[model samples]
Target: MIQNRSLARRGAAVVAAGAAALVLAACGGDGDSDSSAGHGGHKATASASASSSASASASQGQRNAADVAFAQGMIPHHRQAVEMAGLASGRAQSAEVSKLAADIRKAQDPEIKTLSGWLTSWGEDVPAKGAMDHSAHDMGGMMTDGEMTELENASGKAFDTAFMKLMIKHHEGAVEMAKTEQADGAYGPATRMAGEIITSQSAEIEQMNKLLGKD
Candidate 1:
């Protein structure tokens, strides 16, 4: 009977040890699973954060509707200014008027190309030459067809006076548009250009006023 009890005790100890090992194995498996799940969750969160940052960066760089309008509207405006400046080569009586016109052409021509490039990159349509003719009067300080015709027909001192007056009006319009861009645009380069336009054109306006003998 004692021998039987000893054998039975040994069998019970073996079973108990086996059960403890199984429980330890199960707990180890659970820990490994939790660790793997934690690692996976961290990777997923990191990926999501990276995606969000990329999206924000793209959004910040993207042009908005106001930027498109600024570029579109300014292109034709610059074109008209350039055309008017071209007429001053031999027709302007005052050397100052001629110099001003040349400067306008020089400054605005490159701007036109730059604006065109922006529109092209953004998949926006650029304004065709003379596109502003029909709607010029509606824009701020843009000359009517009649006024442009008159300027084109004038010469000598008459040409100089007309050029200064009309150019003052044109510069004013450009300044206003620039102000709107500064106020409403989201593009960094465009808004910076707008600020530059406001400063330069405002100075030009003052200069024209002095030339025209206006306070």
Candidate 2:
């Protein structure tokens, strides 16, 4: 009877050991599953962050391109107009002609500075110092050096008449260019400014024509 009792106890011990082993295996499996799930979550978060970064980078690049082109094109255009205005201010005999030139200079100088600031911010080259190919693009009403010289040498009524004629042409050209930009320019600020220029310059053109009795 003692032997039989000892055998029964041994059998019970074996069953308990098997049950413990099974429990340990289940716990290990649960740990592995949790670890795998955490790794997957990390991967998903990393992918989302990467996509967001790429989208932001693309948007910034587009903005930079638009800003650069606007500054590059506009700087030279403004410089030429300012030069013409300076000549008009000095040589124009009519009060209307002088005032118009002064107004142009006032408006354009600030615009030039604003555009230059954008160029600097974008790390783009400012206006090139050399002579630009005004002929390459239909730069409206741009005078040659000879034409400007003639205007500078004229006096009295001739100066007034010539200044009015030249300035009218200049403003017309600018209006056309501004219209082009309004249609095609990429940035919000640049397109808006282009529209404004078109409206303002068109009105100025009409005023100058009226002043010259050409209306």
Candidate 3:
């Protein structure tokens, strides 16, 4: 059974709503900070201003629905890829497959952090870490429980073949989603991330296909 994604999204909305009140309070506090000039107050104030500027620069571009959907959708997609990659350790027959898994983890774990940070900064909900609504979100390349079970239960050549095939499909889905993001997303960082995914994963897909003897 698919979980409801609205719950996660709603949680994000509530946090954003609460942040508004905090923002107002912060504005009032900013006005009062200038009154104090003792105990390195000027230095502290300068540091705070610099931090705020950095945050603002990270959030410079206009975020739209496309950006929101891309982040929300891709988080789960990437998580699933990482989970699949985790299965490739001793179970893989091919040394290349094991290295590929490590590479996927290296690339995606930071991206997960990046996406989570963006969602927090944008007042958007980061998708929770557990079960997700794959059907509702219509994420193109998620594995079903049975498929995960099959991969988990397999070993040697069977594992290698299944991992290659499934991962190719997974990469294809991410590439499609990323392309949409590049075409429609308004936020600069989000769009750039999308472009990076397409370039990187498209190459991976081709490599995996060749490994599977599908070339």
Q: Candidate 1 — worst ten consecutive residues by lDDT sum?
A: 128-137
Ranking by lDDT: 1, 3, 2
lDDT (tens digit, per residue) of candidate 2 on 1-215: 99999999999999999999999999999999999999999999999999999887665444545456656777777787788788875567788878888888998898889878767776778876555785524466677777778887887789888877887787787787777766666666667777878887888889988987887
- Expressed as tens digits, the lDDT of each residue in 141-177 for candidate 1 is 7778888899899999999999998899899999999
Best by TM-score: 1
Q: Please write out the lDDT profile of model 3 over residues 126-195, one tens digit for every residue.
A: 9888756657236787788888899999999999999989889889899999999989988999999999
Better of 1 and 3 by TM-score: 1
The per-prediction CA RMSD against the true structure, in angstroms, equals 3.8, 4.8, 26.5
Error of 2 at 22 (Å): 26
How high is the lDDT of residue 117 in model 3?
A: 92
- Better candidate by TM-score, 1 or 2: 1
- TM-score, candidate 3, is 0.71
lDDT of 3: 0.88
How many backbone clashes does every candidate have?
0, 0, 0
Q: Top model by lDDT, which number?
A: 1
